[model samples]
Target chain A: MTAETAVPPTAAYAADAVLTEVVGLLVEVVGDEILIATEIDRDSSFNEDLAVESIEFVALAEKLEARYGARVDFMAFLSEMEMDEILTMTVGTLVDYIAAQPAGEPGGEV
Target chain B: MADVQANGLRFHVQHLRGGRASTDRPTVVLLHGLVLDNLSSLYYTLAPPIARAGFDVLLYDQRGHGMSDGAPTGYDVDTAVDDLAAVLKACGVTGPVHLLGNSYGGLIALHAAYLHPESVASLILVEGQCLDPAHSGLRPAAGGYPGGWVEDVANTLNLIAIGLECNPLGGDLGSRGARKAARMRAGADTLLNQTTLIEDISTVRLLTPGELAQVKCPTLALYGGASDLVDSGPMLAGQLPDCTLEIFPGAAHALLRDAPKELLASVLRWLETHSPAAPQFTGSAGGYRLPASGGEGAP
Candidate 1:
């Protein structure tokens, strides 16, 4: 894990900031061509709207781990969800999850 | 998201740390089925629980699959096994690891144990097609498919190849798009049309009973009751020295997708019983045993 500072503990907890970070990760997974094609927002559905494949979703989870660290247990959150719930999940749902986690240093080991 | 260079190809690999950071449990490496399957099947369903259960998990996309770099050739079983060994080496996993494979992936795992017994601790084969058509005499009845598992798979792939060649999915990525589906289709199209994947599968050297017997490690063979490949379970259980067979009721070939909860339970239980740290059970009859009762779908 790199020691360089990430989003400060306070800003990392902000809903809008988390959303921006998530969108950035999404770009990394799906590529910027998607951004030009579709407008990603809080209501954008990962599956239906973004057309994010399951494997790409896993990549997104990896990015979330790198950005937010172990404080946000994305896999655990998804594990608790039914397949249907997961498919129907939105960007807002994930942003809320990230923002709701207890503030901590990014990239910190659990 | 790590791009591992193995077998002269780039593979996309993911490692999930176990909950118990200093645990003695062996790492679990997951292999997905053929085309239309990837590490996500196990990653979303099994990896988290396995990691939480104190077993580190490793997932990777095989050659010409998922996010991995596609190759024009080298899709045979031996190549697949070599790719696995190379991937493990590149990932720095030196210890014997448990291999959980689904469908085609299962066949590769079984062969890995046979070829490199020292590297594999155990095997969890879900709907693994193990027997060679020639040895098993699995001839398709008059007017049936064609030959055996290999031919059947080849025929299926041939159809897919034709379809993909004709349609050419993802051609119009700009307008009217399901980008994910289109991208997957495009990947499949290239692998099927441009590569020797189908020919490689058709010519794959399946495991003989003699070869299977050589795999001495503890093996758990899982199958869906309604699966076409269920017949292979009995053959594996009978041939492998120490094998346990389990059948999921009313499920089809996709055990990981259809019966994930049951699959996870069985995996966890099998790992616990077979773990080196697990208490030794004296005088347990081991070679090829089914459950006491209700081996099929029974309430």
Candidate 2:
């Protein structure tokens, strides 16, 4: 799960870059075995497509915190969503959230 | 993905940092229930708002549950208490902290406070089954189960074990392309079928009234109004010296899942009134920090 591009931490990441990072984190979470059967993409639904269980989602949140730092606020993003919205959320939803963050800021609201 | 070596086994743990970097409030540790339950239950529910309300939160999968290493033995309440102490030690949590437990986890929390009173600041028990039916009047006639809480839970697990053995839902779900569900089912199958979980649960020594009276920490016990374990709520409130009880109307045993908003409201209010530190709520401004390198995050 190596970063394909070394974008400056101060610059806002492109949507594609966030997607790649998210997919890499997913690989770390659900395992690379998932990649052998299905191609992860922006449209991949966490529940139906990837079968991301609640515990695995927590793992993904931890990874996102490690990679993108506190500006990502994955738990805050989740706190605003209803149960159904969370279950039906897609990879693009998270990627877009990450991409929208003000790059390299000390702190920001989700 | 944090794993802590505690009680001679690897346990999955998640720590959510609060709003302030430094505060006098105690860190909140949440414990999930038995089979089919994990840290995620509280992780998605009470954990976030509690963190947002300026208290560092800790959630962990108990032994033989979730991503933690399983064992064929040691499922009794005392062992679970030891595991909690060991997990706290492994995580470097030395100060007295709050313990919130749901269902079986509630039983563990009660025992922990009773045994290690100095280490626990407070307790929150949600549908905790700590009293024996014979003594607490939680017989089969009241809860519609075969026996007391322990016996009823053991019977339910035995039924699930038999069903899993006969049908093997994990393999079936995997064949049907549901990998996550299959994995969860398989983990449950291993714990129920292969381990001494049922036997250990059946032999659990329910807390006596005298012991409950000895747990002097401030306690909040929440239960669903319609849950089978609702009876324990009043009993806990009556026994524990500093206990407050709340029963959500029309909710069942799964209070966290069924009434998360209400649960969050109660929990936030409880922490606010009881927390020693000044309340600081940054809302979305709250963010959790990953443990520093070579800290609890290390495998």
Candidate 3:
């Protein structure tokens, strides 16, 4: 199912824009008060740089799903990575994955 | 984060199909433990490794856990079995599937196989408890929870409650941690004490040794050598017609988290032996049956 959003389906999200939104979600997950002055970059890793716990990552995945809809298969991307890869996964990697998907929600299926 | 309507409830499910081709290859379904645990347990620990090994993986949070809708009740084994069937149906998985259940999830796998034999190809139980506590001698006193479990549950809930206020996560994680902890604490209270889960589990029907022996599917049972429930592994392995038991020395009930590498190694070896993709079906009297060229990989 397509997640209804103001942005048109034809509009492609840039990698930098996606990273910014990802960091926004991270800030929400990390609590706005704590990450008030924190700056996130493409090189920022979820576990190492952001200290994202497993549960927090689950929340982050949910947020990504809500934002990107079916265009990105976060679960599939995660399932392909090793434990160490997950610990070291960066914002740029996820941004690239999102940007690399078909412009539409062609990634709805496994 | 995929939401599918199953058994009249919204279930948060994760379905990851790998590069494995052919429908005959069984999809690996992973089930996690009770309250406070979700699909993330196996997602982080086993799902990726199994998927990388050329197997499709399905993992989900039980009702009332994780992002799934939390109804006030329906936490019994029977409901769990039905949920499994519904989940498989929702995913459009028509072929038989392999199941890996950790802790209480093992009971679900066992009962699902016992009740609906055609749907399940095989089972791998990780630190699983037997259905018949009587057989394993792990039953609790009448109307009371298991001796140590009650205290453990209480302590866990208390810790969650206390941890929320202490900001143990410190820095930026504290707020999110507290929020998650509080939510978990609330769920633990409702599921453990207020719900029928305890009584349902306590009174769950036990399959006799004769019945267990009749379950002809391949089975692999693992338990931590230092775990209190280590003996149950042998009990299960002894009863199942085709079963293999593995014990991780110096490990405990938290074997999945404690020694994940060893657990993954054992699981991969078991999967290699079973090789769900290797075609096991020969002459079937049912529809949708595909014959394996030979019994090379047939169990």
Candidate 4:
């Protein structure tokens, strides 16, 4: 899902580019009015801090799959997290989770 | 704060003593979703019927949650649990009480009950599953993620946004009748911005079967048929030592709003069966067999 960026990404994003991308996606869906950072911190919560609407969150997630060439298990993520808990994630965290996954196919049964 | 103490912190609180049972008998303490204040979550729908039900009910914000006071440190399960315990105590509730937990609240219910089994009589877990280390449903790639890291991040964010909007999120605060609406939004933003909480939450996905074996109480595990939220419930039911599971066909994770009537009735029946002393309700139990959307399953 890599696209040619007008400007090359520096090592700065390398730390948690995925997280930045997610924050970027959130910016698009909720608009600039909603202030959201890339790396979710311990204190962040959706209802209390992000003001993200559930419907909007769901739509954005579906759209995310199209860019990455994968189908993420939407429900799986939902069942486990709270809005605040969601804010603390980092791009590095996802990279680690995906990097270790078995090759071939996406959205495993579990 | 309203001087309500749960665990150890003081919280803003409200009470509707054993209100109307939308589903019927037995007092249920309606828990709010993640980061939402008591007024934001309950003022919209739950409080009315619960008051009329004649069963005792209590609603309060958690520390660092909603109007509840935020500690200098941050939010965590242990703090939330303490707040819950304190609130129950303030309400003068000592014996076992029915639980109506939603989203993260569901996690708290299970944890609190396990920690203090004598406090929780039965559980009405709505779209929430246990987080047992052994049964953790989603296997963290041992050491990695499944696909493009950037894409995964975007997907997670987008999905989260959609789920939130569909929920009972109140409207803009600009309107006079909707001042609280603004507070609700502000609260949401606070909830979403916590990066640490997200990382911490990721660590909990599935509950081990052994942990489920410990929940011996009669539980009515409710899930939305249309929602992926069931991923958590499957393992939760499988692990729970005693559980009566039912899927509200067609509804999403926010069944309370998506199919309020159906869910309300089903919950009542579940209580009646589990506890014979359950009270009578204005709504009928059979009305919830199908979806409120009127088709195959639950709305």
Best-performing candidate as measured by DockQ: 1
Better of 1 and 3 by DockQ: 1
* Docking quality (DockQ) of candidate 4: 0.01
After superposing candidate 3 on the true structure, give the runs of residues whose Cα lies further than 4 Å from its correct spot: A1-15, A24-56, A59-110, B20-22, B131-176, B276-299
lDDT of 1: 0.82
What docking grade does candidate 2 earn? acceptable
Docking class of 1: acceptable
Separately for all candidates shown, the number of backbone clashes (residues 3 or more apart, or on different chains) is 0, 0, 0, 103
Which candidate do you rate higher for TM-score, 2 or 3? 2
- Residues B73-93 of candidate 2: C-alpha lDDT, one tens digit per residue: 989989999999898889887
Q: Each candidate's iRMS in angstroms?
A: 1.8, 1.8, 4.2, 12.2
True lDDT of residue A99, candidate 2: 84
Which residue pairs collide in model 2, if any?
none
Candidate 1 lDDT at A100 equals 83
Highest-scoring model, lDDT: 2
lDDT of 2 at B106: 92
lDDT of 3 by residue, B40-133 (tens): 8898888877877777888988997776787767887789988888887887766667889998888788878888777678899898776454
List the TM values for chain B, per candidate.
0.87, 0.87, 0.80, 0.70
Candidate scoring better on TM-score of 1 and 3: 1
> In model 3, which residue pairs have backbone atoms overlapping below 3 Å?
none
Q: Write the per-residue lDDT of candidate 4 for residues A1-55, one digit (tens) a residue.
A: 5665765544334425545566677677667655523334423344444555433
Give the least accurate 10-residue stretch of model 2 chain B, judged by summed lDDT: B290-299
